[model samples]
Target chain A: EDQVTQSPEALRLQEGESSSLNCSYTVSGLRGLFWYRQDPGKGPEFLFTLYSAGEEKEKERLKATLTKKESFLHITAPKPEDSATYLCAVDFQGAQKLVFGQGTRLTINP
Target chain B: GAGVSQSPSNKVTEKGKDVELRCDPISGHTALYWYRQSLGQGLEFLIYFQGNSAPDKSGLPSDRFSAERTGGSVSTLTIQRTQQEDSAVYLCASSLAGTDTQYFGPGTRLTVL
Candidate 1:
């Protein structure tokens, strides 16, 4: 069965703190890994799509790196505005749908 | 361009009432998707529509749930005899053809009494 798991269910970071969130997956054939940021009462916003192992993508203070079995979203010196639930999803080759992980709730104190 | 849009930002109704939720995907997007998210759970896939091809309905939770994408643009999800378990935030997303990145719309929060 294809499954995605995100660790550190909740994290509280002070402003300007750096941390990483993990997303591990088990799938038949990896197609793509996606990261999204969802704020309260809003829909999720697309962040990155990592298609292969050793691939990395960055945006401002956020960077996402992928591996064979997992992906990491590293936040560099995050600000309070960066606080949101980070979601991870994997698209397997044959599934044609995304399997999402229970998101990591991040709170950056101002 | 406008992003995906969903109607009735919030809805509350009796348990047995039927409900319809609408989604307007981004203009020119060829792929549309529906999902549900409970208060504390991750997004659950419900259905997918791609162009004129048959939609992937494998993710629909039950026969009571059905969706239709007309003219390959606007989509509607209909739930017959809604149950408390069906109370959730229904989210809609769309993507360009042959792409994995999906953009979502502000979800519709449904509550069953």
Candidate 2:
């Protein structure tokens, strides 16, 4: 069975603090890995897509790196406005739908 | 360009009732998808429509859940005989042809009483 697990269900950090969220997966025929940020009462906003190990993408203060079995979302000097639930999803070969992780709830206290 | 859009930002209905949720994918996007998010749970895939091909219904949890895409643009997800467990945020997303990056719309929060 294909499964995605995100660790540190919730994290609280002071403004300007940097941290990393983890997303691990067990699936066959890997295709792509995705990262999204979702705010309260809204749908998830697309962040990055990594298709292979050693692949990395960055946007503003966020950087995402991928491995054979997992992915990491690293936040640099996060601001309060950056606080939101980060979601990870995987799209495997022969699958039309994405498998999502439970997400990491991040709160940045000013 | 406008992104995917869903109607009735919120819906509240009694148990045993039927409800329909709608989604309008981004203009020209050839792929549309529906998903459900429950409290503290990850988003669960519900359905997928790609162009004129048959929708991928493998992820739908039960027969009570059905969806349709008309003209390959707008889609509707209907839930029959709603139960308390059906209460959750239904999200819609769209992507370009042959692409896996999906852009989502603000979800519809469904509340079953």
Candidate 3:
């Protein structure tokens, strides 16, 4: 069975503080890993997609890195607007569905 | 361009009643998906539709849940005999294909009392 687990169920950070969230997965074959930000009362917003280990992608203050067993989402100098639930998902080989991890609730206090 | 859109931002119904939620994927998008999110939980995949191919409904929780996509554009999810446990946000998303990045819409909050 494929499984995804995220660490630090909740994080609190002062504005401009930097931190990283973890997502570890166990799957037969990894096709892709995705990151998303979801606000209250809204659906998830796409963040990044990592297809292989040693790969990284960045957007503004957010950076996503991938490895064989885990993925990390690093938030640098975060602002209040960056506070949201960060979700990680994995697509297994030959599977059309994505398995998601319990998200990390990040709170950036300004 | 308009992203995926779902109708009835909120729906409140009684147990044993039926409900239908609609989704309009981005124009020209070939893939559409449905997911459910309960309070404090992760998104759960419900169904997937790719172009003209058969839908993947393996993730649907029960026989009461059914979905259909018409013209490969609009999709509808119907739940029969709603239960209190069925209350959750039903989210709709679209992508170029199953392997593409999915764009989500504001979900429809369903409340079964």
The local distance difference test score of each candidate is: 0.93, 0.93, 0.93
Candidate 1 per-residue lDDT, tens place, A24-74, comes to: 999978989999999999999999999999999999999999999999999
Q: Which residue runs of candidate 3 sit more than 4 Å off their true CA positions? A: none
Q: Please provide, for model 2 over B1-113, each residue's C-alpha lDDT reduced to its tens digit, 9 standing for 90 to 100.
A: 89889999999999999999999999999999899999978999988889856458887899999998889899999999999999999999998964569999999999999
Error of 3 at A43 (Å): 0.6
Instruction: Kindly list the per-residue Cα lDDT of model 2 for residues A1-110, writing each as its tens digit.
Output: 89999989999999999999999999998889999999999999999999999999999999999999999999999999999999999998888888899999999999
Question: TM-score of candidate 1 restricted to chain B?
Answer: 0.95
Cα-based TM-score, every candidate: 0.98, 0.97, 0.97
What DockQ does each candidate score versus the true complex, computed on alpha carbons?
0.78, 0.82, 0.82
Q: Write out fnat for all predictions, comma-separated.
A: 0.74, 0.85, 0.77
The true-versus-predicted C-alpha distance at residue B113 of model 1, in Å, is 0.6
How high is the DockQ of candidate 2? 0.82
Q: On residues A1-110, what C-alpha lDDT tens digit does candidate 3 reach at each position?
A: 78999999999999999999999999988999999999999889999999999999999999999999999999999999999999999989877878899999999999
For residues B42-112, what per-residue lDDT tens digits would candidate 3 score against the true structure? 89999999975545888899999999989989999999999999999999999888888889999999999
| Native-to-model Cα distance after best TM-score fit, residue A28 in candidate 2, in Å | 1.3
